[model samples]
Target: MLENIRENSQGLVAKIILGFIILTFAVAGIGSYTNSVDTSVAEVNGEKISQAEFEKAYQTQRARMAQQFGEMFETLSNDANYMAQMRDSVVENLVNQLLVDQASRDMAIRISDERIKQTIREMPAFQVEGQFDNNRYLARINQEGFYQSSDFRDYLRVEMTRRQLTQALVSSEFALPYQTSLLTTLQNQKRDIRFATISAKQFEQGVEVTEAEINDYYLANPGRFENQEKVKVNYIALDVNDLAKDIEVNDSDLESYYQQNIVNYRQPEQRRIAHILIEFGDDKATAKTKIADIQTRLNNGEDFGELANALSDDTFSGENGGDLEWFEAGINGEAFDQAVTALTDVNAVTDIVESESGFHLIKLTEFKAEQVKTLADVKEEIAIAVSTQKAQDKFFELQQQAAQLSFEFPDSLEDAANAVGVEVKTSAWLSRFGNAAPFDNAKVIDAAFSDLVLNERLNSDIIEVSDSLVLVVRLNEYQAANTKPLEQVSEQIKTILVQQKSAEKAQLLADELLATHKAGDDISAQLTANNASFEEKAAVARYGSDLDASIVREAFKLPHPVADAVVATTVKLNNGDIALIEVTAVSQGDEQAPASFEQQYSQQLAQAAYQSYVEALREQAEISKRENITSTSQL
Candidate 1:
């Protein structure tokens, strides 16, 4: 279990720290400080992990995990083993971070202030309406309990510097030509074969099993027969939907609401506009002179479409002579949009409008006027609103009646249902964690497991399942743990035996098909006669775009196509079918593949080499730090 946990470090760590932090901050959140504290727990060279620093770092990790998991924290917090695993991860992460920080200082790695600001401005979290918002940035920092912007900036700078150093150390490593060629050779391969599977249903019809064998299997697996805890509850429910149906919407109020929100009933006029654009940067004066020349040509009655096609900097619309499709107000830049909207008629041309995208000479090709919808046109919408309100009112009325009955009777769900004019619903017997029927809701299951309902046999309190439904329940009776009799489980055991035999038969048939193909017997005719399709995938790369890379990798390892060295492979599908493959052809290409495909494979190989280098560096650094820490503590 620990080995599996180690393999999934990120998932395990996230689960462990799901809820602990209400008051601590992680080192990543800490601002810069020049002074070292004496209460350091461990040091990487002269750098210290002070007790205060550790507490802060721990708290930040806790808060981050809590936010990510939200309400699921209860499930994680209840697991003691998971929590312990998370603590170990936190310590390891902190130690590695300290080492990396110290190494950056020793190597004199520094990140520029401009780079730090640029990174912060690009962060998606600090953006408001698609652009960086200063107020949002400050609010986020304040929410995280940071006092100053410079403090957060300095921390980010150090982390960035450390990352740069790691990248620099690892980037030079590359895979050898021999390794690359071997990988490519293994990718370009194909499989061809004919096969059939003997399904379990085919053999299950006539299969027989003795009663004694079923009894023996049941006796050996007593844990499977143990009765799970169950519950019943008696309660009252308040359904909002029922109440909403009885509520009324007055005609005057509907008219008033419509008048107040009249804008919703009207559609704004839109215009189709296009423009010849000239962009300006540092050479603003030169760009202005060029734009003026184009305007002069246009004033002289030169063809706008011809001039735009030849002179426009907007490539996206230039090919169509600067013809942009229809757009509503606020769709384009404010200055450009305002100028276009001001045009009084279709085919109107406006003076050059300056915007962030540069200067644009606008042409309005078409226009649409606003159209307002009448009250009669939206009657169905009003009807729905009225019905929803009435249903909510009725639901609450039912809840009040049921609540009164529960109070009066104090013992029966039936009495409460009778008082509310609703039917009493009883659920089938269900295990505590089993999804047996409608009673499978987690909240309902938790309520069913409560001591009062499960053991005391008392009526459950009214519980809200959703806004529209409420339920009261009670445990009727519980079955105790006992081994199921042989007669009860005989059919299940027989089915299992049939499936096992079917799988073995399928494997045998697949093996024979491969053997026949290897012996130079053509199976294409047999496959075609059986209505099985044959596909030929040529020049398949190791990192195949369409097929699974793992499948392609295995396929390429077979002997050359001419040799007919068939390699049998079986793919275990999620749906219980074994996809048997027999390799028929294999080939290797010398050149790097196309740019789009080659780049992805190159990056994968490069990253793997880089990660291996970083791990080696980290291991050596850790060993040296451990020795030094031990010596200092002894002293």
Candidate 2:
């Protein structure tokens, strides 16, 4: 089998293609805005940005945030208002990118075919067993809506140019030494503070949640106590690997393919050559005589290495027994190349050749002409290639058939399965947030929950589950959304009610205590009188302190204390507790700033420059959203 083509980061692609986006945004702390949709939802300087396009970009960002937010993703996504704001943010991001994309067009940059292919090779999604699978790459591009490879290449060209432009802007930015020094000093600055915790749990024992409170909370928040609707689907899968097994590759097919793509078989010319040189000596005549004698001795079968090492005046080659490394054509100047080429046979010494340098004797140590693999040598590889292509062609045919047949016979997937030569299979229960593969794929879940399949009891549209698998599914089993029993959630409701009351108590007390302290009633005296407790931490560095990070961040953001007066504030902790913080002193960092500070600050400023440049572009641009589509921008 042919080895996988190597994945290479293309230098040319970096120069002319989308270098700017990845280079700047990924390193500049703005990477989350890299992907967006491109059709007619909005217009930037007259280019259409469709709602569908915007939604695609929004989903991509959501998926990325899901990874970053982890446990918080569920809470954030479930909040309709938050998700709406996120969509508008996505629109803003998309518009910025579109501006860059439009600017890139003015530069008229392009990506070469080889570089685009290299990019495809480097994507792990197109690989199998650590090797780039050409079929998978093609199929994936097809699924993504680029029907032709050249069309995909053109898309890459447009995308790459945009990044190249942004990267150029970011690359040209720099931070001066004084700027970094100042920033590092401020960033590493220390603060001195005393703080006291008002634990919500302390008030919880006295916070009695009555039965009426639990019932009211549960009834008001019904959605929170309900189970997610789940469903099971039966589907027909058309897999490319199964189709490939059915393909019968003939010898003639391999031969024809080899002849059609003969360029891939070439092995360039190679040679190992050597020479003995007699640089014009004290007398040119003497050098000529000496080279002629050396040639005669070589012709008489004197050991070439021994004679050349002993007498050749080209001392570098002489030290290596007159052996030069492998020869490349037109490299050593015309005379030397001609002399080496003129030697007719391997080991045959050339005639006394006089050059500007001196007289020379040359020998062809080894030679190999350009090569092409014959059909017999690569028949197995060719067969595999031919069969895979044929299988892919069949898969496309069946994919279309499955889609059409399922649509034509909308009542069930049986007709489509029969037509596509695949058996009907069933999937287990899955929810909207399922993470199981195959059925859990976003496309599959979307299709399964679509109105046609779920409500109408009709066959779903064919979903491309992966590069190799195509599916058409129908509803089999369904679970309706329902709330849990009152008895089942009573204890959970009680806990929630208790926590809410406790947090209110803690906040009210913390606020009163803060007010009393700010009115010149010394906090220490007030705490002592109330038999309350407090902890004093000195010299709390901005980073790596034993105190809560949220508190630390807030503490640093607070204003520095004036002499004889402390800076004080109340902060909410993650545990629903409240803390009272009093800053007694603040001090600048005295240590030498780290070397990385300059580069880090430079990138930070570069990112800011990029954003400012994009914002300027937006101001100049005529951006319009669809009248019906409401987003945070309109708000």
Candidate 3:
């Protein structure tokens, strides 16, 4: 093959192939060759949304859902359909963000850096006692997954710009007076209605399921009585909180830990300085020459602030006399720190310093001297840290031993529990789709019902239920899937058949009454004469009805009474009974919709319009998505 290719390379055919290859590289670059596999969850207009980006976005979305749904989050997450929706939501959000960024760029929507900084400064989370706190701002952004202030600034700019676009679309939407009027008329429409309830219980008394009928239905639906394969699990749980309770820290331990970690307790010397930076752009000689000229000016008693404002490459600090703010050693690099630390007096200037960032001319404005604390000041904090460290070390040892024992002795978890000095706990009956308490988590459930544990009858390897909780399980009792005896479910079958027949009888009576009313005979009189109560409700709104909610919904679903004639219909009630609902009159509210309601409704319509706008943009945009990567083997 090599010889053939080599000989062909001199021919016209090979030359044509080589030309195409070169052109491909010219268009796509060498990255196209290196990245043999595409790892993007989605792509919009050739911009790839990498899998890592999707995972991060998914985590953020999951956290939001956890916060929003609270106790329901766990159950919802376990629901395959809901989780699929959640994954879809994450992908949609990523795609929408890319779309927004692309559209924003095309439309020239850009927020100023100063505006970004101002937005951060004004955030309530970053404020301390009604004032912006720099430390608080930094800590808050760090918690939000942006460790760098600049990164946070960029994030805020994008988010703010997105909000601006959304507001633009919303503000442009308007609901006309006629639109509001029509909406209010429909929303405030009232129906004067009456209903006659014919209870299923009246028919149920006469409907009976014989033994033969029960047997026949039970035989027909055999799978309905089949129980889910379940296991009663006896397992051992190890929790960090329980282990830490017995581990004690003495005064000697605290003294030793405090001394070993003394640097953490001491405050580093902070230096406040201003500097003019000229990056190594275009040519090293040009940058060097610029820095040297700045140094000469500084040496000749020239204004450093004015020079920085005019010549510094860092525009952010340049605008403020190149103030780099307060920072400690090792923060501004070793070379820069050496110059700042060597300054003896305030207003001391250093010669041009060369660092990885580029050339810098440092000017010292002020400094805060380092402070060391005695053992008494941070005694409590030290004690806690030392104690936690010791507990963690012991916990780690037990964690390893328990996992090893569970795996080595796969038949039982007792040995592992005893070795770790943890209690062996047991769980009530648990099936593939259901469990209780600690075992209720999806990960633990998956591990419990695994082939190794459920089929092979082996102990589970250590499962991390949470960061602090670990578990190893073995099947105590297993019940294979089996159908219940006919005798056991006979009563259940009877009740079902009885309900079916009773409901049919109820519907038949309702249909007959409805037919008579439609044929011009009053059925309400006959119902009342037969000892059936006619429940009459007047001026019933969409809500706040005394009738069954389902009936109210059905009544509202009914058309308005026409030409001074009553409208009647038959609807199946939720309780398996049937009701004859009659609407005598229908009326709309005389008053106009309130300002607040009109505003809210208009905003709702605007939101719907904005969504349509986004959909339209999506229709025009070229989008490719990978669905298989959305699921995890074990969530």
Candidate 4:
């Protein structure tokens, strides 16, 4: 529904509110959401990071990754290495956030209440038809599964403070005009060069690999040919989706669900209004007198919108003829909300009302009554919800039974399968890196190879594979790691040895040609004598897609020529050919940079400096990790 709300709205309200709402569902990033707990998972500058916070963040990250990777997401989530890294990253971010929070307070960074209100009013989300609407603001904030206005304000305040401090640190970062121009010249510089290729394949006919060499190579790198460790498991599993298929929902159940969760289908009343405010800041009598004149003008049949546009003190609302669009009660303030709601007729002007901002003369323009959906209108949705609930209940019950039975009968999975009314299934040969269905889960793989399951022949604990699935695995067979014999890999080693010797010969030829070119020898005549292919490139810049990126990058590395100098160097191409390059001429690029280039260079330098500043802060701060709580066991 919130997603639907965002899709239907085209204002800043959707952007701001949806960004926050989506963040709640996002599980990919590090760091914890604000939470309260007594037992500490870590401590930053004497501040305890609670266990609840760590668990929540860890699970959220796991779930987010699972969703992102689809089938492979579970494999990554269950990986011990991945889990460890994610946990450490989350803790590090939390510590950094705490450091920033402390710094913000120590520096006396403050955001006033009025400023907060103004910021909220200025947001495009709260505006309708180019002006701030209090009702729209209230509607967005009132949506469930998002932060309350107070909490959101606090978040915004902290974010603003952090941004202010960051900008202050990097605000002075700049690149000089001369520096940018110099770099631009180098980036666009082109070179005229001729390259002669010496192919390794030409030398391959002369290269030979001996039987003894192949034997030696195979013996030296035996581990390279070793077979991976593999396991087979027999498991009893319960999946929630399977249970959901059997779930039954009656019409009465649907009716009961609709009655209980009816608010989800409720549409609140919305009001559109135009108003004239005369601010009484430090001078009430003057403001009252001004409002009286406006009231008289309204009584004389003058257009209310035109008058409000010209006279209202609220600049944002005044720009749109004091139009505040589509809002429910409690959005602005109690006094203002009551005044707007009490109006019964369109174009009716209210008596002078007082609020924190000032005195207001409210005029109603449009209204929409509250609406509630009939039970029949939402019957299918209710039925689906009721069925899901029942399915979840059955799944939990089966999971509990399976867990208990698996523990009681640790030697075999047959008893657990019988108890849970599930079949014991056998898996194909599973390896550590394999990502097959069911057995792809890291937890299942670890449990299958665990000492208890392998050596003691005990049933593993019930491992939760995903939100919908659980597995109790018993190892059926195991293959010990072993290296393949030298005979099996001798032919493979021979091919590699032959290629290496050929490449060495080609490089030697390229080097000889390079020395001749540097010594002022006629390499073009030498290349013609040897029947080598010589090709000339008129101009080549620092970047291009048509030529080899590696060769192009190497061309720029050559120093500028002095007095008709011929600089030579050799590069190994991807096809095992040696490219011996000799620069005959060079053209330096323009030194004056365009405006866009200058801006880009300046921004790059600023970003680099900001990263350095952040790193320095982390290095200077005192950081500590809890001994009992590592990423591996946090959850």
Top candidate on lDDT is 3
| Number of colliding residue pairs in each model | 33, 15, 0, 4
lDDT of 1 by residue, 187-222 (tens): 443344322322323434555556676677667776
Any residue pairs clashing in model 3, and if so which?
none
lDDT of 2 by residue, 26-96 (tens): 67565445644343667889887766677678778888999998756877877978877787788788888
When sorted by TM-score, best at the front, the candidate numbers are: 3, 4, 1, 2
State in Å the error of residue 540, model 1.
9.7
> How do the residues 1-635 of candidate 3 rate in per-residue lDDT, one tens digit apiece?
99997897899988999999999877787677766887789999999999888888888788898999775688887798888887888899899888988888889998987787677668899776997655455456656766445566778888999988888899988888888888788878888888888877777787878999999999899999998888888889888888778888888998899889999988877777888888775587999998998888888888999998999865556667877667455544689889988986788888888865578888888888889988999998888898788877887889999999989988777789899997888889888664676877777787878888878999888888877788888888888899999989998999999998998988898888888887778676778754576677777888676778878888888887787455888888888988888888789854498879778977998999888988988999999999855744334
Quote the lDDT for 28 in model 2: 58
Q: Could you give candidate 4's per-residue lDDT for residues 471-583 as a string of tens digits?
A: 99888898878988778877778778888888898899889888887888777776775558678887877776367776776777887667857777889988877888767
| Model 1: lDDT of residue 451 | 72
Best by TM-score: 3
Evaluated against the true structure, the overall lDDT of model 3 is 0.82
Task: Show the lowest summed lDDT stretch of 10 residues, model 3.
Answer: 133-142
Candidate 2: count of backbone clashes, pairs at least 3 residues apart or interchain = 15
Order of the predicted models by lDDT, top scorer first: 3, 2, 4, 1
TM-score of each: 0.55, 0.48, 0.77, 0.58
Which stretches of model 1 miss by more than 4 angstroms? 1-73, 122-133, 166-185, 194-212, 221-236, 248-410, 414-423, 427-441, 462-471, 476-483, 498-584, 587-596, 606-610, 622-635
